[model samples]
Target: MTGFAQLLDQLPLRFLLASAGCLAAGLGVWGATALLRRLPGVALQRSTWLLGQATVLACFLVILLPHSERLRLVPPIDVADMAPSRAAAPQGPTARPAVGGAPAAAVPGADPASWLTLVAQAWLLAYLLGFGHAVLRLLLARRMLDSLAATGSRLPCPGQPARAPVVIEVDAPISPMLFGLLKPRLLLPQHLRGFDAAQQQLIVEHELMHWRRRDLQWLSVGIVLQTLLWFNPFMRMLRSSLSWAQELGCDRDVLRSRSPAQRKAYAAALVAQLRLQHATPKTALAFGGVCASTLAARIALIREPSPAHPRRARVVRILAIAALACVFAASLAFQPALARRSAPTATQAPFSCTVMVDAASGEQLAREGHCDERVTPASTFNIPVALMGFDSGILKDARAPVLPFKTGYPSYNASWRADTDPSSWLQNSVLWYAQQVTTGLGAARFHEYVQRFDYGNRDVGGDPGKDNGTTQSWVGSSLRISPLEQVSFLRKVANRDLPLSAHAYDMTTRIMPKRTLANGWEVVGKTGTAPGLGRDGNDDATRQYGWYVGWAKKGQRTVVFARLVLDAKQESAMGGARAREAMLRQLTARLDVL
Candidate 1:
């Protein structure tokens, strides 16, 4: 996937849209079902109604299934490498070069190259499955609609039928809407509209109120979603509840203009219409998705005094909200502590591979392996270089442009096959540019800078008295400070104890990538790349490590350290992917950043 697409996949918009649609459709279907079942002598059972409702939802969901694609990284794999050879083939007679060139000699022990084909194949399979499901659902919905259209008849009116009220007429005998908001369509039989004007007016007013509120539209949207994600029972309940609330709201509105006596009359009119119409309206809106008991309860509610909604319910709701908030806060507070508790004990912690000493106090907080590991110091060594450069007159200004240079010096790990400008080299992590800056600073000066700052292990090799230069071993030559030491150096840099000016420090820090953790903490850090670390010669599988030496802050700055290892063969892409995940999890557990 493209970088932009990958980024979008991580966002929550797709989930939000799907959830909202499902809720709306569910509520609408429930309201319509309730209204249909309330009608007298309606033969359809709630089970049948629910089945049809689900079918309708499934069909709508199929149409909207295209929006929910997510992107994820896949691990890298190796493939055999085949190279062509150029030497002339041995032959007694003169032989022309073979077609498509002769096969080249293979490297004795080299592994194959890495490819990302696995993820691509998986994505293809998922896409095909989703597409097939959507097509099948759409066809099923079309078939159901066709069958309904063939068997159902519209309510006949005096002249051309006027758009009276919006409803989802069901196979029920009810005249009043059962619910309000979600898909509040009106239901009627073949000749139900021929009822007396007064009776028709009352029914029309109720359903019209629902239509005006746009309940049906929201219901349709929700049903589509429910069909797609039917497994979530909680979502289903929410849909049903919302539909009930919608119907109640419509009833209140319809009754507002009518007197208590008029409402009673309206209820009576509904009964008369039910008796006159032999068959219930099946065009969605006839309301009444419930049984006789619910119908009796609604009628009773209408006949009895209109009881005001209790204030206790509101108080209970407030308390519920408060309780939820408290639970959320408690969870947030507990996660980090739980993480720490679950973490391995101090004795199980990795040995100090490198000792981290506070620059200001010269204090060591953690240690790793027994032997002092020597690393090439990678870009991290640049901090001291910049500092010493500022101290000496040679660098002169901290703002001096990194100049271009060319060289072909070979190094222990990477070959300086060709050279470029100093700035370009540093920008691209070119060994030659980095070495020149290191060399220009002089061995004594570089050693002094290392000692003055306590940036890392001070032994530069050779005698302790002598200002020895770098190590000879390729692995040993790499900048090898552990995560703890890296953070210690950064803490000092952030404190600005070194002679380097603020401009120099800020410039260096600004170059690092900005990563915002879930817990609202922000970190910035630089990355490093080295070759020959992996079995493959290609850079794709090369060994990679990074020092995310940065500060974490909610609103103010608090220094923090993060180190990452990269390998194309693991954690999908480069090692940064794994490192980022670990750091993000830690940050999230510690603070609710997002």
Candidate 2:
């Protein structure tokens, strides 16, 4: 039971769901094509096939869009929440303590959950490696074609302009193929010179038809999609079907305005090229050399070609469009909604909130809990405080001088044992340091900046006469903000849109910690913790509230997020440390961190 649960937890349910959707789309496309084959003309078959492929691609895209609400369908499971048998849990160390203190608990043995996680990670790595290798192979094939084009001589045909695809006769054993995107060229095998002018024209016409239709560009798109979804066999099958459809479509176009004799000549040319044993580059579109089954289908379709009926073709077009619309709509509508969990138990902490937004577009990617619920900004207020301090010239620089630690202050954290600079103060969450900065800025100036930045509720003046009303209001007193607000503020800071001096903005960013993951992605942010309040408005010593606000950047993509974990029990809380851990776990699970 444990192993099975662990396996289920590690399963890539989302990707599996997408694969199933693609399979359904493929079946629909194949069914439409099967029906088209029974119709009178081959003209509608090409458009039908193209529309089916497009529909499948569109459906796959819809599946990839960010749907935070649907995330409930695969809510993450916290392994720590699971009850473990006493015997399976780690026991106290049997050996005597070393010089530091009592020996730590024995290291826990690997379990089913850990093994399952490792297996999942391995599979992901394999898929990435395969995708990279496939891309490299494509690049190599393009290089090979460039080399062939460079060495081969351009065969001049009368009436064909120089700008037109100059026919290049290469010393390769492969069949004639079309290569290049910007300056397309037709490359013919050396053996092709032995054929009569009529045979050569038939081969050239087919390759030229591919260029007119820009089949190379479409083929490139198909190749890229295949590489991305290499792990999905259905995607591979879809690529194959699309390619076959493309070849058939080109054949239909070539024979569209040709006589019966010309059609027979093109069919003979296709068979003659098939006898060659060489394989063409995957990146290029070849005239012949398709598989035996595809060759057979092409010949059969060519033998009895019928003229397209305008009215009947219009009807088929309408049906194809309708079918595509239905498939796309069903793909989105059928997405499984995430399962909502029941209320938390008494011992468990109340649900928290986390919202991740794209900094550039302000698009919400994923969210959990009630991100809009107002809560005290706690130490997170330090961000705006530092900004205001710099803008007002109250603080010159982040590293100018150090302030002596207030020895008389009562604090639970042991890290605040010595005087610290602005950076150190931010890192250690030294309340005294922030209080000093706020007091220096004073109430009027602070409130002005707060209102300007639209900080939280814009209520810097907390309940009067309270101990925390004046200077400490932004902490755990009265001033409040939500996860969504935090994200917005961070985005403004990142974009330098806030009303602050350039120096102040740079210093604020410099003081904040930036974490780099194994894959070279970076996360820059600050942490804040507030004291939880009881129903009577008194501080609740047993519970704490934590916040982690930051933006993660990889290449050109930047995601700003804010996480708030409330009502955490004392033993399980480390202020912002707890929030950071929770945020990182959720980010890893929801985002493609690897």
Candidate 3:
């Protein structure tokens, strides 16, 4: 169950919807074909088939057409206590006086420009998709005609007997042939003879099967839709689905007037044709043969009067319809921006290290750096650290102090410094303070918070060098984190659903230092300096790493960012501070005009 949920969460929205759409289309074609097969009488059945198809085509067009353009009204509230007097509601009373005897203005309806723009975009997309499919159908028909002509088969004159004017001309090689409207053509090479009387009848019957049901036209339409929506896997599935339906529909059509023996002979003829025309062109439809699996199905249908038994066929049809209906219902029932609220408009407040989440409708706002290459995060790691502290009781309040002294390896030769405080140390990104907090939280409590976040790391207070962390002077080893992970952690922090109390969270957020720009706006962030890893200075003596991350909320935009200077030496570990400033300069410049 957990794995299933994870898989669903990981799936892209496009893939999920496409899968459902494909299934719906396949089931639609299948159920329609099956229904056509069950009907009795060749002429009556074919008429019904054509009628039902035309009805479906009409319905599809209705869906494609633009809906009525109507203004959506905001429903009026029946505020009984605040309801205006009936006389005043519909008509203007004598001009009302303000405290100074001035008349106040009435509120006007908001501008509809944004809504209109969205509506136009939707209509444009629908129009493009619809016209694209139509163009593809024309192309498919043209190609089919060309493929048939290349095979050198001639179309028998219309209204002639099924096998009239049958000639085995020595001047022309015999080729395969298919008869159907919408570019109907034949396939015959430069050197083959006509089949005997019985074989010719069966072949002609099979081709007529396609014509009777207009299977070629449906195939062309389905092919066009598939081509237009090529990115959708469901569209790809529709091709095979409609292809199967067309063949099945034709098979049943052929069965309607033929004896069981005649059916088997026809199936045999199809197989023979497929073998004879081994070089079947992709552009042409060959009446005599097809895919091996399709051929096998036809043969099986010949042997069994009801290949899909009546009862089973009905069950399959019902199941397919029910599943398809469920998918369509579910898709249509959805409201927009369900995952997150619609993000604040460009005019709303902004976040630094900006996580553009829509708090109202859950729509994610578009932003920069979404396409930037990934980078390893350094001390921005502490955001999650602070989160763990808040979630668990250990390292409880932001205001509470835990000023401890140093006696570790890097400071072994130096006297113990006793003035270490959590608030100040955290603000300064002191490594020793972070380690002390981690130790105070205890292994069991620490693991609990780690599990909750599922940050993909499993180390429980292991040596930094041994795990994903690198060795640092003040803190023995520190864990590695990615910039993306840092932004994610900050989101949870800002959301205030983590372990800390509302007050503590507010205080910590408030006390965090902010770097003020030339303009009035200030940016809040934290900085980290640590020993570096891998190819470092001689014996790793001077290796260092630096990190800074925080959010900046400007009008309507809250940008959260993380910066890192990995594998540096000495004071260069503080390079992240300068990098953060540069990044902010570029970002703010873009936001200022907006």
| Candidate 1 wrong stretches, greater than 4 Å | 1-187, 191-198, 217-229, 256-285, 291-293, 309-594
- Model 2: clashing residue pairs? 72-338, 72-339, 73-338
Off by over 4 Å in 2: 1-65, 68-120, 336-594
lDDT of each: 0.43, 0.67, 0.44
Candidate 1: lDDT of 583? 53
Q: In model 2, what lDDT does residue 445 have?
A: 74
Lowest summed lDDT across 10 adjacent residues in model 3 is found at 78-87
Clash number for each model: 67, 3, 41
lDDT of 3 at 433: 59
Top model number, lDDT: 2
- Cα lDDT for residue 182, candidate 1: 29
The residue-by-residue lDDT of candidate 1 on 269-369, one tens digit each, is 65565455433222233434333445565566556535444464454344433433433333222211000010011111121122233334544433322
The better-scoring model by lDDT among 2 and 3 is: 2
* lDDT (Cα) of model 1: 0.43
Of 1 and 2, which scores higher on TM-score?
2
- In order, what is each prediction's RMSD in angstroms? 20.8, 16.3, 21.5
Indicate the residue-level lDDT of 1 in model 2: 18
**TM-score for all models, in order of appearance:** 0.35, 0.52, 0.35
